[model samples]
Target: MDTITHTLFGLGIYKAINKENMSKREKQTLLFTAIGASQIPDIDVISQLWDTSGQYQMWHRGITHSLFLVPVWALLFFILNFFIFRLKSWRFFWIALLAVFIHDTSDVFNAWGTGYLEPFSNARLTFGTIPIIDFVIWFIFLLAFILSKKGSYKESSIYRISWIMIALHIIIQSIQGYALYKQYEPRYEQLALSASFLPWNYSVIGKDENTVDIIQDSLLTQKHLMYKLQSSDNSNLKKLFKQNPKAQTLYKWSPFVVVVDNEERLGIYDPRFYRKGQSFLFEFIEKTQK
Candidate 1:
């Protein structure tokens, strides 16, 4: 998910807690614990600055977002809270754990995925059932905030109900996406899904040999072929990889790529992000003129 969505998740978690009886200082510390842990996993983005091998694609959502690191992040936050706020309650640790756990787990639902298992496994586990920026989740949080201000309900109760609604939305979306995936599973050797901004809509990418197809469909609508691409699997990418390391990293990082070997260049691009006449993730090297 994007930074804004993650930050909202942090605030939502903080608001869900019943802090009416807590001291002002305790509330401040709790808020920090929730938001801080939520944003901590994304610290891996800094690896780009030191990435000379073009492995930034694999390193961005790498080990730091692993489930194994959740407890470590929580512990760090717990200790920081102790020193800064002079508070030693285990509640901080538990809250931080929940925040970090949610941060790691939620990322798996997006197409970007994460290295959830990390050292145990290097797979980019992605469901692609949820968009990186889910307006539904934002709406839920906004509704809860408005209800807390306008209605007589307690703020904590409102936020808790919002969380429940968000979970239900994810569950429903995932179920639909899974069904859609299975519906088209038999047609291709490899398949990947990407959710649209609107709920219940998805873009499905399927590869059969060197042919790639991008179809937009939903349970309610018939499949529409958006783009059909051909991959130059026969082309030797050894020189391409040797010349541009990032291209090799991209080839490995993506679930699948549409290889381009034409008169002008040799390149590969992720079909999942195809738009207009090109893909944003495309990398290529122009041929030297004779």
Candidate 2:
């Protein structure tokens, strides 16, 4: 998920806590624990400064976002709260753990995925059932926030209900996405699904041999073929990978790539992100004259 969605998750978690008898300082500390831990995993973005090997793609959501690091992040936040706020309650540690866990787990549903197992496994566990920015989730949070302000009900109760709604939305979307994936399972040797920003819609990328198909589909609508891309699967990519290290990284990082070998260039791009006649995740080297 994106930064904004994660921040909202933090706020939702904080709001769900019953703070009726807590001191003002405790409330402030809890707020910090919730929001800080929610964002801490993304700290891996700084690796770009030292990323000379073009491994930034693998490092951005790498070990820092691992489940193994969740407890460490929680402990760090607990210690920070102790020194800064002079609070020693274990509640801070537990809250921080939940916040960080939610952050790491939520990212798996998006197409970009994360290294959830980390050192134990390097797989990018992506479901692609949820978009990076889900408007339905935003709407749930907004509705809960608005209702909390207007009703006589406790704010915690409102936020808790919102979390339930959010969970149900994810469940429904994932089931639909999984069904679509299974439907295309037999047709392609490799497949990837990316949920559309609009609900119940998806972009399905299926690669069979050297031909890649991108289909725009929905549970209720007829499947539309968006693009048919040809990949030069038989071409030797050694020169391309040697010339552009990022190309090598991209080739390994993506589930599959549409390889381009032509007079103009040698390139590879992930079909899942292809748009407007090009893909943002493409890596290429121009042909050199002899």
TM-score of 2: 0.98
Where model 1 places Cα greater than 4 Å from the true spot, the runs are: none
lDDT of 2 by residue, 1-290 (tens): 99999999999999999999999999999999999999999999999999898899999888999999999999999999999999999999999999999999999988898999998998888999999999999999999999999978999999999999999999999999999999999999999999999999999999999899999998899999999999999999999888888999889889899999999999999888889999999999999832
lDDT of 1 by residue, 1-290 (tens): 89999999999999999998999999999999999999999999889889888898899888999999999999999899999999999999999999999999999998989999998998898999999999999999999999999869999999999999999999999999999999999999999999999999999999999999999999999999999999999999988898888999999889999999998999899988898879999888888722
Stretches of candidate 2 exceeding 4 Å from the true structure: none
Provide the TM-score for each candidate, comma-separated: 0.98, 0.98
Task: Enumerate residue pairs that collide in model 1.
Answer: none
